[model samples]
Target chain A: MKIYIHTKFQESIYQQFRDGLEPKYEVIFGDGEVSESLKEQFLTCDICYGNVPLDWLNTSSQLKWLQLNSTGLDPYQQLTEYQFQLTNLKGFFGQSVAETTLAGILAVYRRIDELTRLQTKNEWVGTPIRETLHLLHKAKVVILGSGAIGLKTKQLLSGFECKTTVLNSKTISQLADYLPTTDILIATLPETKETIGLINKTYLDMLKPSALFVNVGRGSAVDESALIEILKEEKILGAVLDVTEIEPLPTESPLWNLPNVLLTQHSSGGWAEESAEKVVFFLNNLAHFEKGEELVNNVDLVKGY
Target chain B: MKIYIHTKFQESIYQQFRDGLEPKYEVIFGDGEVSESLKEQFLTCDICYGNVPLDWLNTSSQLKWLQLNSTGLDPYQQLTEYQFQLTNLKGFFGQSVAETTLAGILAVYRRIDELTRLQTKNEWVGTPIRETLHLLHKAKVVILGSGAIGLKTKQLLSGFECKTTVLNSKTISQLADYLPTTDILIATLPETKETIGLINKTYLDMLKPSALFVNVGRGSAVDESALIEILKEEKILGAVLDVTEIEPLPTESPLWNLPNVLLTQHSSGGWAEESAEKVVFFLNNLAHFEKGEELVNNVDLVKGY
Candidate 1:
């Protein structure tokens, strides 16, 4: 069998994946984008991993499955429009992203960046404790999306005794009601047609002045322009953003300079062992595929999760 | 009856306290230091709230009680030298300090300060994820001083599924055994003869290279010079100190320049509503004193915590 590995990972991790497959199958390692040589591999390979061009879905009759390297299915929305099996890397990143979400929120509420700024200047002055210090205990937290990341965030917040309400596609209409009372609004919603630009000015306006907005899922879901304006004017307390509408957030973006906003540069779903973990997951799934067993994390294409 | 309040608070809170106590008692508002005028008031006042000079404890024949505005009994170590009812604010600052501890730990583990530095320079790049990003989940955490702050930190770590062990004075002898394996070591111990300089070179060397040290308790418990050397040399991971040996940690302190150290400037015990809570506690204790009832949070000066 011919398998095409199209994920970007360290050479050692790729070597591990190659060694784990043994001599039974031939493996072609390449980048996510399908070039002419990758196209040749995709045409004859029985399985392809990582992202492929949306238009390349129908290019091969032998392509049996496509596994994604990420949890978000936005890039592969056309999966439903085709007949191939689609599996995503889900459940794995929830812990990493959840940890980042907590890190971001706590960093902001504790005025961590402000202190670091003072440290750089060798200033001994302290932040106005009464005006800045915030306790996470019993806070009203609204987590958007009921997926793995959101649920994990809810579980993590339980220790702080925060009152958390998770909103999914079915109940997102009630978001306006939740915004007014939320002390922390965390968006872990993936980008779909319905979710794009969901956090517009209207939704942002409902939040209290002390409310903190956190986005760890996808950037397309929020209206970044509106958020930037609100942050610039100090309308809300602050934001802890791991995902923005753009990747490598443009150098001139106001979000970078905003004192109240913490930009994590899309590094939330990152850990030292993530590459090794991915290799293990891919190998396990490949073994299952060979045995004719149903693959894990097989997404419902129509639902676009 | 005569009462002296040595802590400064809001005018509205002072008014509330004054109004709560009727014509039966004389109330004197003053500073923590014992000046000539404050000494005169302390001579007559049976109950005083906040700091009093160590030598002046025996000068007041009528002094029956001393109410402290802080949790640490380090400054008033000599309180045991005199015979008087000593009550310090105990459980109140736990949640605030615990929140700060988590914030500091998460910020360090997630490289929040590094990202903030990048943001200041408008750098769109992320820190090397493979070298930095860490999950708080499943981390082996050991908390020292099983008081309200230590216990609360343990409770908060439960949601992250971290293996947390809280050590009090009784079991602190086993600290060497725990330190070697601890991924995160948090100290919430108050200053005492036994605790001062407890985190010396010997104890710090026992920790794993990746271990993070957090001190939210009194600064006297840690040997500042030892910590400074380790931090400067990058021997251990880093430290998150909310309390240092000195307030407004001197401008010349190397901790300000060390990339690994995060100095929160003793703001962990701060929150917007702390003054109100203290006022309520004082008034309640005053009412208890007036009714000849034993006060809550009454400290045994012999134990010095």
Candidate 2:
């Protein structure tokens, strides 16, 4: 059986992935970018790791399984039909993303941004800055989605004694009620038909004036223009946006200059061992696949998760 | 019957303290300064709710109790004799200080410092910065002291799945064994005779090159010059210094301009309701004092905790 590896990992990570695979299988590696040669090679493989071009998968009759490197299935949601079994990196990113969310919230609450700025100037505004500092302890937090990321975030917040409310499709209707009292509003929803534009201007306006908005989910889940407008007007305290409406955030975007806003630039689900870990996850799932067993994190294309 | 309030709380906090006291008791509010008026009032008071001058307390024949607003009894450690029953605000700053320590550590681990700097320049070095990002999850941690601040720090670190070892005076001898493998080192010890200059050059040199040092304890607990030398040489990853040896640190201090050092300027024990909460603590302790009950957080001057 032939396997096509299409991941942009470092050389050592690729070597680790190659060493983990059974030596009997024929393997071809792509550098995560689609080319004429990659497309020809991808079509001949029975198994593929990493996200291959959807069009290539659509035409390939040999492809039996395709494992995605990403958790979000936004791009593949529109696919009506495919022969390959689709699995995503769902639970793997939970801890990393949750830690980043907590980092952003804590940085805001503890006045870390202000302190960092002060440190640059060698200014010590000691006693005066005290009153402006906040605490995550006993904060009222409302987290959107009940997926791995949201659940992990709730677990971390529990350690701080935060009163966290997890809202998903089932409890999303009550988000308006929670927003008025929420000290921190976090969105970790995937990009689905229902989730897109869910956090529009109306819901944004419902948030407490002192509430901190955090989005580690897909950018489409929120209305970026509405969020930007409210943030500009100081309708809400501030925001920690790991994912924004556009990648690179267009250098001219107001979010870059916004006083209280912290743009993590979609680096939340990252760590030193991110690629190596992903390779391991792929290899583990590949072992199960070779044994003709049901794979984990099989995405239901119709449900669009 | 006379109670002298010598705290630099806001007018509202002083009013809160006044309102909480019994109507029959005489109350005199001071601006937390040693003036002729305050000294005269301090000498006549039967009770005090702040850290008064040591000489004034020594000579005050009428003084009965002194409730210090500070958690550390650094100055009082030298007092050979006193008539008053002294109590410091121990355990009161646990949550606040712990949150700040976590905030600083998380800020470094998740690259909040780098992201914040990038946000200022409207620079989005997204994928490139991913390799530099780290996680607090599963890191080996070492915490100094077993007081409320240290215990609280450990409790918070548990949420990150960090393997935390707490070393008090009894367990401090084992610190050298842990430092070589520690990813994060936190000091929350008070300024006692035993704790002073505990984190010397030798101990700091034992830490891993990737270790992050955090100090929410008294600055005297660490040898500032040694810490500065190591940080300048990049012997350790970075440091979060909440309490430095000098207030407003010196204008020429390298700590202010150090690449990765986060100086919080001794504001860790602050929150929005800090002053108000202190007043409530003082009032509760006053009730105990009035009833001839053993006051909470009673400090032993000789032991210097």
In TM-score terms, which candidate is top?
2
The two-chain DockQ for each candidate, comma-separated, is 0.71, 0.82
Which candidate tops lDDT? 2
Tens digit per residue, CA lDDT, model 2, A95-206: 9899999999989989999999888888889988889889898999999989999999998887788899999999899988888899999999988778889999999999
Pairs that collide in candidate 2 are none
For model 2, the superposed segments whose C-alpha errors exceed 4 Å read none
lDDT per residue for candidate 2 within B97-185, as digits (tens), equals: 99999999989988998899888888999988888888898899999989899988888877788899999999999999899999999
**For model 2 chain B, the run of ten residues with the poorest summed lDDT:** B72-81
Checking candidate 1 for backbone clashes, the offending pairs are none
How displaced is residue B36 in candidate 1, in Å?
1.6
* lDDT measured at residue B186 in model 2 versus the true structure, 0 to 100: 96
Q: Per-model C-alpha lDDT, please? A: 0.85, 0.89
Report the error of model 1 at residue B32, Å: 4.8
